[model samples]
Target: MEVMKVLHMNGGRGVTGMGDSSYANYSLVQQKVITMTKPITENAITQLYYSTLPKNLVIADLGCSSGPNTLFVVSELIKVVDQLRRKSGHDQSPEYQVFLNDLPGNDFNTIFKSLPSFQKKMRNQLGAGAGPCFFTGVPGSFYGRLFPSKTLHFVHSSYSLQWLSKVPEMVESNKGNIYMAQTSPPSVLRAYHAQFQADFSMFLECRAEELVLGGRMVLTFLGRRSEDPSSKECCYIWELLAIVLNEMVSKGLIEEEKMDFFNIPHYTPSPSEVKSEVQKE
Candidate 1:
């Protein structure tokens, strides 16, 4: 799947669409990511490392955006493995092969530039016993296979699953809204849900093929607490953006018609929806 646009924090920092202009920073977002997934990630690492401390371990971060956060998950995983090794009575560290996957259009140059510094830091922090880390970029949509079968032991993805493989068909009819909104018609909601199901299922299937039998994947993304797809908790942020766009149209800064066809290719699945997908997959 392809992303028609690249939407990211302004200048690689704060939350999107906030007026703070408060210098770019991902601390807030990073905190949420860690809060939601750190425990699970830690547990998964413990289990994986103790279960079979493979001498050579392979990890991939799907939808790994380019920035400081790109290596955050990898760094944490490495540390966990190191600690687990000690607890498991192992003396030698496992060799690491990390693959960073994102769309082909991602800003890979920045990641490549940061690799030298990242490697140096890892070396210092993880020590000589920390086996060599070979980081490589694998550009592609994670909805399909990007690695050889059973090649990956752990996979981590954060702040990405909300994005569908592509925009749902007939979403152009979702006028006056850029994403799921209270005003969106039933058909629009169905289209979005269907697209999410298809995309997420493909993601699971592909990962299932790539991971070993006991491999683990830690994924975190936006989701609604309520079952309703258009619940305010999920769609309110887009609603706020729509309000801003309407104001822009009133000020003649953009065309009124432009808002009619603009829609974000994102879907916030409820817990049940996620459970269903996992069970089905």
Candidate 2:
């Protein structure tokens, strides 16, 4: 039977366990974080100089999931801004107001619990005369407005935007697959691509409204180097997972019907897709 398993992945047990299984402590994910450091530093340096320096800076880190990784970008910003302010011979450090945003169901308390250490580290890095740094939690989906118009100076997000806001309609024809797999029908592939396009466009539109005229945003998420959405980088892992799940179905460990309709609401777009969305925005 071709039917949709209307599962809302959000506000589920996944939200609660996220902080525990966080990418912050994972080695592979940490490597990506390291790889991003140079570009982020350069971007901050460029943006800091690209405009007249503001005395009070407003910064937001979108998709700021709970864990050490959540503070990774924020700490980097504090360092860059502090060093630049000192180098420019400014007697006073810029006061920073940082907003950490994520879904309302996210474990923000974990982030809240870790703040003392984060602030202490910031103080230790910036010295005893560090500027006032305040961090606030803004819980909501980034596909819509989270902050006021033209208020943010800098925004950064890492390894988050692969999630679609919702699954596309008419995916029942693409049965027996949990995501974009090698055997996924052309119709299934088209539906997934269409969803990504819609969600990503709205993401850009919302961010454009929130950013200042010259504000900068740095985002790095899952994406394929090739134009093909079903390329190995995008679909291989899900393909393997599907194989395992189907194996379970064969062994009678999982219901065959459940296997037929389950689909993951995640999409890894190609570089061209991202550039197109940015240009459209």
TM-score of each: 0.89, 0.87
Per-model CA lDDT versus the true structure:
0.82, 0.75
Overall local distance difference test of candidate 2:
0.75
Clashes of each: 3, 0
**lDDT value, residue 257 of candidate 1:** 79
Maximum-lDDT candidate: 1
Counting only residues 3 or more apart in sequence or on different chains, how many pairs clash (N, Cα, C under 3 Å) in candidate 1? 3
Candidate 2 per-residue lDDT, tens place, 34-141, comes to 465757656764676438588778889887766556777777777877777777788787788999988776667767777887788778778955688898999777
Stretches > 4 Å off in candidate 2: 1-24, 27-31
lDDT of 1 by residue, 98-183 (tens): 99988776666667777888889888987767799998999888878899998999999888889887878873488778888888
Specify the highest-TM-score model's number. 1
Question: lDDT score of model 1?
Answer: 0.82
TM-score of 1: 0.89
Pick out the ten consecutive residues of candidate 2 with the lowest summed lDDT.
3-12
